[model samples]
Target: MLSIIVALLVNLLIETSVSFSVVVPGDPVVAHVGSTVILPCWINPPENAEALEIRWYRKEFSNTFLHYKPGKVPDMPVEPYRNRTSLTPRSDQSGGLKDGDVSLRLEKLRVQDEGSFRCYVSGESSYDSEEVDLKVTALGSTPVLFLKFLDDGRVNISCKSSGWHPKPSVTWMSDERRVLHPGGVFYSREAHEMFSVHSWTAVSRSDAQLVSCSLSLKTGELKDGRMDIQGIVSSDSSGPWKALFFTLFIFALLGFGLVGFFLYKCRPGKKPDKEIVGDVNIEEPRKHAVEITVDREHLHPDLMVTKNCKIMRDGPGYDHTGEGFPYELCAFGAQRFTSGRHYWEVKLTQENTPPKNYWLIGVVKHGNFTVRDRSALTPSSGYWFLCSDGPNGFHTNTDPPVKLSLTPRPERLGVLLDYEEGQLSFYNIKESKHLLTISTRFSGTVVPLFNPGAGDQSPLIILDCTKPVKSAEESSQPLLSNNSSNA
Candidate 1:
């Protein structure tokens, strides 16, 4: 009976002294680049892990990613995983080292971090380990589409995007859902281990088609963009027929020149009874590009202007003094225009924000010409500007206020102030389309005005238009009065 009891007690001791196995997630842990992730790992049966040696490594046992022991200082991981790796409790388990949680906390995850990690733990008697798989992914930025008219009369559309991991797939499709063959696909890896993709396709211009390009990952991540390519062609993309017609017309002009000379020499001399005495004057719009900067003294308290005075945005939680442009988020340019034509441009998508919906961009009378509300912002009251009220639409601050219909809203707005002509014109610099013109008489100084309305994420940025650039098509067309409102 005594022997039997001793044997049973020894068996119990053996069972209690047995080693514990390391437990890790059965499925691969997924995380995105530039994010933090916890690779779950723990010891079964919950034992104090503080006294045990913990090591996390990649392929080789000698390659230590993270090492910890009770009395020894923590070992630094490999160069790649140096400061980014730390031992912490599993997300679901809060007991940490005391409760046997030995999870690895990785910060600023990189694409190279996607692999198998071995979590090894050792006690006085035995050691065990388990491997955890990590999968990293990155969703790229929005794809940008570029259109080019081929010499063969086909429209070539190209799509480009960057900052994606795992090599995304590209798909080209039409509005009818028919898949089109891409001309070529090219990809390059960036310094950060992310991929940039560029693909293009050529389509006939015979039919109008709405095309789309989609970038996708096997992880069900997608970024897509669409552009209407129907009848898409550059303004000067006329075929060879136009050149042939010009050649023939030049020959015809030469033949007419000879015949006119013959007639002048053969016909009798004749003189007009009255000599033309009136002078026909032709004037072209003069471009006087001036560098504009925000006047810090007159800036609204709620407005935040950059140090360069080029960018302005709303600053919330600002205390109003109830003086000087109260309740208005406005800033005036330091450069004033009393005469000549001054042109400047504002970028509506600065500071990584989306296209602005609410903004007021134009010129206001310099000096103490202050108005309380929209009603007071009129030419008669010395304020002439164009306003964008988001989905409510766009308008000008004329006497009665003229509403405007602008298609494909302007991303880069060009403002021209003809101080002598008393005309303020707005142009969509991206599309080269004239938006509107305000006609009024100017007397004193007028400064460039800007108001980034509330409820927008982007900052109003005034670009450096020291030398205003104008395309041939933009310069040839005259500003039409059909869209103008006389103030």
Candidate 2:
């Protein structure tokens, strides 16, 4: 019993010899406007030292600081940090007595709390050595995507935030419950003391409606703006629709003016309006009419595609591909394009038979993304067709072959290719949308691309591609007609 008592006393003495350490205040940082914040901190030594008192401190001047004493408050501290501090002891977290987790916890944080902090501790030994420092910052106000008005009845929107230590990203969402990806504007400028971003996209297209702009940051998610307008507007209609559209147009234009003033006067850095990042140059015209040939191969009705340039699936939530092949990245190509006044066109086809499942087009951008339409071409007898329009201009797509009346290649004029069972498509110098399943009798998407009409923009890259196999021959026999069926 005597020996055991001696052993216990020695152990307690050794433990009491370790120095106290800090748990919070390591570096300066930022917190979103309304985030439940934690101030990380820990002290040194080992296990026995866990019971040490934890305190939080803030240095006012070089030598003066405001600190909190553990268990109970110390006599009286400086006026600045009197009632604004707290200490949380975490024995399980402290690196044993060798280290301590005497961190600070601050509630209902305010903007002024952005600065340097200290994790102080009190223990048995000499009340001793400490841990490290921490920095706190005032994050910017929640940035709200503002849907304001524009002149001429079009809609204009912008995103704004303030007080953020590091810049945040802003995105726009429409009533379609889709994200409007921003493509051109990735650069940002400093506003007052925080970061600010203003992107302009003229909303003028079919089936347009309500939208929301979302702001995200390292701090957290903060949505703060609302759509300020009379009502909804559809891009597919005219007239009375014109009234609401025009109203949004005028308001959006006005919003544009306000954003311009703020961008010019408040924003620190600026770039030329026309210097778009994805801008590629193309001016060469195709001299020899290129040919697309296909050969019937596999006996499966699935999609497969082959192209010259590598593809990039930029929009969020999309992964490249699978099985025998993977996507490779490369530079972009230029294809000729004539703005259809306001949108672009694409021809869609279904090689086998149209499935009950549906697909939509996602326009990739950095901040806001735009989805053209859910049903590009509806299933007709064996195909589907559509004419799509948006702020990006106009575009046409393939439809299930219509019954007489009248239905040309793509409403406009382009190359149309398909098979008897399914697989429909129309591609020009500028773009291509080959989404379909080839009849098992012909399972391969091998379209030998030919440079047509004008311009070199006929990029080697083909987008939204399904699994396609490469082919290089123009077969005429019905049994041998690969149909190149995969669009």
Candidate 3:
């Protein structure tokens, strides 16, 4: 009887030790907004967890995000995590549950997703819980600088950017490195829970030289944009030139030959007609055709790009594992533009396919292609795109996505970039219909980007359009006019 009692006690001790020892990651898990991250939890000593119950919930609110049992299907997640959360096994073999892995996978991480989570496991007579902290980070767009002449004679220097979480800070400084306070600031929250900020500082003519604008996050990410105010000559400095031009104009008007010349130059009904082609009315300043090829080095892992960098398709073996984070099936063009006007086209090659379920075409700052977060693909992040998704339809990838009404989607799309004018326009090449235009000051070199969403086997083919040639008379004309008024 004594030996039997001793053996029973030993068996109970071993079973208790094996069932109740739960382990979780000691350090906090860090992830970016719109990214998927894993919160690791497992049974110590590697005992099978297939028959146990696992629950992951917010430590503060006790709101469950995931709950799983061995034999029955997991319970429906709460409102916030309806379809965006999942459980991952610890081992690739035995389906992970048998290996005691109970890690929780969170998809499309949001700003509110940052906090402590509790992983609770329970068995017949053993129960244990561990806490895991999740931290979500948001990276906003590159700062853009704008200089506008105010009606009161002060120069309004403004900076704007979008696509940030946990709103960031904006600062303006003069060439002397003195901080300038903003006269006004504006912030807007986007559909994806990101932020856009526009801040302006009014400065006197004397202080217009080199002004800088910076955007920063608490995580230490910073982007700066600077403008040379000297290039924007003050209205006061051009007063003498304007007066001289006025006197010369008065003298010239006194001559009969000058009067005839002026009448010819200013003919009321003789305005030059702009060129119109197909369905497009070409009102642009100068159209220069550019050849663009894909940049394979920056392409996402799930994209299969052709050697010539003209075609792209989804990788056959790419898997999403059902997590709802936006998959990055994008590639960047090799060409970079900083000045002048350029036009390029992309044609969809697949036939008999419903309009692509997802597609994106736009320009991004040279290095921004590597950012995996979808929020980083906003205008504020140095990215401007026209995107079409199955649910969202067609829209400009702005802070507040601007929905487009495109009838008979064009298979061929045209992109026009006017660097000097701070304009990016899109057109339906096949239909010759104008789609949309984005106006924003660009601070640095930008490259073309294409994201043919996952599973989209259709290729995006780059087309070669003929460049417009200028006639000898048009080419010889002075590009700048000395008689232009400064005001």
Those runs of model 2 whose alpha carbons end farther than 4 Å from true positions after fitting are 1-64, 67-75, 88-101, 122-155, 159-166, 173-199, 207-210, 219-231, 234-487
TM match of model 1 to true structure = 0.49
lDDT of each: 0.75, 0.35, 0.71
The best candidate by TM-score is 1
Off by over 4 Å in 1: 231-487
What value of lDDT does candidate 2 attain over all alpha carbons? 0.35
Expressed as tens digits, the lDDT of each residue in 1-487 for candidate 2 is 9999999999999876755444344354445433445566654443443455544555622332434444455545455545555545444444533344445556555544566665555655555323343333445445444443456666665554445544556666667667776533433333223444444344643334665666566556455455533254433246576577445433322233333333335435664331111111211111212222212232111222232222211222224342211111111112221111111222222223221111122111111111112231212101123222212222222221212111112211232232333323323323221222112111222222211111111111222112221222111112211114442
Per-residue error at 42 for model 3, in Å?
A: 3.2
lDDT of 3 by residue, 155-199 (tens): 887788767776888888988999998888788665456777778
Q: Write the per-residue lDDT of candidate 1 for residues 1-487, one digit (tens) a residue.
A: 9999999999999987898999998999999999999999999888999999999999999998799999999977779888899998776537899999999999999998899999999999878999999999999878878776778878888888767898999999999999989999988665467887888998888753889999999889899989888745433357586666545433322233344333334546644321111111111112555688888766666677666677777776655453333326777888877898887888787434578888898888775323346744656435788888887778777744667667677788878788887888777766765556677898778899888777567767787666544433122222212111121
Model 3 CA deviation exceeding 4 Å by range: 1-28, 44-46, 59-65, 72-83, 89-99, 150-154, 175-177, 234-271, 274-487
Name the top lDDT candidate: 1
Question: What shift in Å separates residue 81 of candidate 2 from its native position after superposition?
Answer: 1.3
